[model samples]
Target: MPQISAFDVVGPIMVGPSSSHTAGAVRLGLAARRILGEPVTHADIGLHGSFAATHWGHRTDVAILAGLLGMSMDDSRIPQAKELADAAGLQYAFQTVDLGDVHPNSVRMRVLGKENSIEVVGASVGGGRICIYEIDRFEVEIDGSYTVLLARYKDQPGVVADITRILASYGINIAFMKVSRKTRGSDALLVAETDDPIVDDVLELVRQLQGGIVARRLPRF
Candidate 1:
């Protein structure tokens, strides 16, 4: 079993009927927005397993919409999230889906902005903690425990080395890293959890590599 922390028992300070279904859902949405790194124009949310069944009872729907609007769990406007989203001109829809072999309290968000779009899948693993499992089509594990750098590039030789060199040049130390790809010679993803914040200059350098790269930072909550 996964080790539990003290906060897991005490729960997060949030507007909630339940931590897992409410606060956790909010965090998941925030994580999605963080990945996008811009204002969301549209979102398609899918709830699976237990979240689909008990979402309404816990107001998980509202919590998620509130999150897509960049509202934190403790935001005073959570109760008025729907109105706030409408005021911000954010469009959204929700549906129940069969996300096989996953945690019960899980959701998938397809978020779009004027300049970019992304898909994120995550699960509320009790307390107010969540684990993001997918980004775009790449499978990943992002729990918001630390600052992370997500890099997308062509699956080619020396790409990882090149990116790491940029991080080293910025005096950033990597704590953990994972790589995923659809197939050889296709696109690939690299997630690096860093001990120090990656500066924008380093990110710009990584993006300049190989003429086709996208890099974004995910800050810890």
Candidate 2:
């Protein structure tokens, strides 16, 4: 059994009039930025249900975009986020998407950068808690705690082993993993949540594999 603390019941520390709509949204954005594999160039953001309709009122739009640009909550630029993105040389857009059967406080983002593009979905789960539902096509649920490794590679044998070996070489342990593919022998992203921060050399090893893998590391703070 787990001990329930007063703080856990009272909730998380955050800047907010609304934790689920604001703070959690920011965390979600940062998480997405991490797995995108490179600095963001173009961004197309979509909000669903209640998020689509009322996000602006809650400043969810600002929070979400700020996350992708790697801006902390205290960053002054959050008030004029679109301008900030442009001034900082980041491309960004915001629109609404109907998210069915999922949480209402949700945002999905498509971010483009120098060498890669990615789509990430996350929901603010009240009290500043957020959950990452997917990245591109991989299905996952992230609690915003651990560093993540996102890799795309040819769907063949030994891929998982190769990744595990490389992580083992560096003493990195995978706490969880999710693999996805649209079809057999097609490409896939190996989404891994690790026990500790990831170093760049591990990514280099993954890129060296014959099947070809685009790798990235995301740290959750």
Q: Against the true structure, whose TM-score is highest? A: 1
For each candidate, the alpha-carbon lDDT, in order, equals 0.90, 0.80
Q: With candidate 2 superimposed using the best TM-score fit, by how many Å does residue 149's alpha carbon deviate from the native? A: 1.4
| Model 1 Cα shift for residue 92 (angstroms) | 0.3
Best by lDDT: 1
Clashes found in each candidate (C-alpha, N, C closer than 3 A): 0, 0
* Local accuracy of candidate 1 as per-residue lDDT tens digits, 90-114: 9999999998999999899999999
Question: Per-residue lDDT for 83 in model 1?
Answer: 88
Worst 10 residues of 2 by lDDT: 71-80
Relative to the unseen true structure, what is the C-alpha lDDT of residue 171 in candidate 1, on a scale of 0 to 100? 88
lDDT of 2: 0.80
